[model samples]
Target: MRINADFTQRVAVHFDQTEWVASPAAGVERKMLDRIGDEVARATTIVRFAPGSAFAAHTHDGGEEYLVLDGVFQDETGDFPVGSYVRNPPTSSHTPSASQGATILVKLHQFAPNDRTTVRRSINGADYVPLFKDDHETVEMRSWPSGQVVPIDAHGGAEVFVIDGGFTEQGEEFARWDWLRLPPGTRTELRAGPDGARVWMKSGHLSGMV
Candidate 1:
């Protein structure tokens, strides 16, 4: 049940090269990025929901976090459109579905069991936004201008998901929907392509995760 489960090594996944695997739920599929267990596990994924599809109601014992990449995601809490970011803390319950369909980047069973904070929001028009920061992690949305070189300190580890345009790390290129993970103590720089790039990043959380 493990994908890129090694936290001590670097990993990169290009969206175009990955295949979608169906989940237990009908009409729902996922691209697993990393995993540490089966069924109920510590995992990161890209999920797509077909129109009129839904997942059964369930409680999150270890919390859940996600960002809507397209269409709309629905639940009793509300309907979230593209760019929506949400966190359902430990013990929260919901029945999620998509009316017309949707795609999201999700992380599951990755929070402190006692954590109860909840967050729901959307990405705005700003080029840079500090989404959230806590003792465990710092999440952000960043934009790079054409041909820019941006330095990043991955002292506590880091994960980045490309949302638009492209960038090169070391000598590897990352385009839209691509994902990259760097081990702790790594120092790196992203060199934006001709069209620049935009990304969602989470850092510090991987320090002691494995």
Candidate 2:
């Protein structure tokens, strides 16, 4: 099934307002953001694992990327706590689970054919750095001070995910976990709220997806 599968248009998902759908595994559920194809698909989602829940071992043929939103997520390699960002490149495999429970933001099958770099970081421990950059694509994380107005010119499309606090865009307030995807050539105006905000932003990834 397809949901928000069109890349040519803009999309925004306030996860707090979405309902969770159970996954194939017991005690695991997901709030789908964008999806294409069937069970095996290119997708973005917010996933949750109830205590003692686990998923069978699986290979990421097209790569997988995720950030732990709360609690802890674990696999054969190690445990990832809240704020951990990880990227398992194409062909990687793992069996994921949660002992105490966890919530994560994840993307599947969205890597470029030749992109094979693997990364694991903690948003709280790592200094803000450029995550990815090229003439056509860029990704980064930044902090916005309270009352600051930040304007963005997305020449080849843009996406933003709030990591902390809240921000307003076109008068709509977006708190942690809110995600926004905009089409190419769009300009966005964002203003930080009283507590300020921290966000992960990406641009130019939609250049050809549209």
TM-score of each: 0.97, 0.94
Q: What lDDT does candidate 2 reach at residue 40?
A: 90
Cα lDDT of model 1 by residue, 89-207, tens digit: 99999999998999999999988777888998788687987777889889898999999998989989999999889999999999999999998888999999889998999999889
Clashing pairs in 1: none
The TM-score of predicted model 1 comes to 0.97
Clashing pairs in 2: none
- Model 2 residue 42 lDDT? 93
Best model per TM-score: 1
CA lDDT for candidate 2: 0.87
What's the CA error at residue 6 for candidate 2, in Å?
A: 1.8
lDDT scores in order: 0.92, 0.87
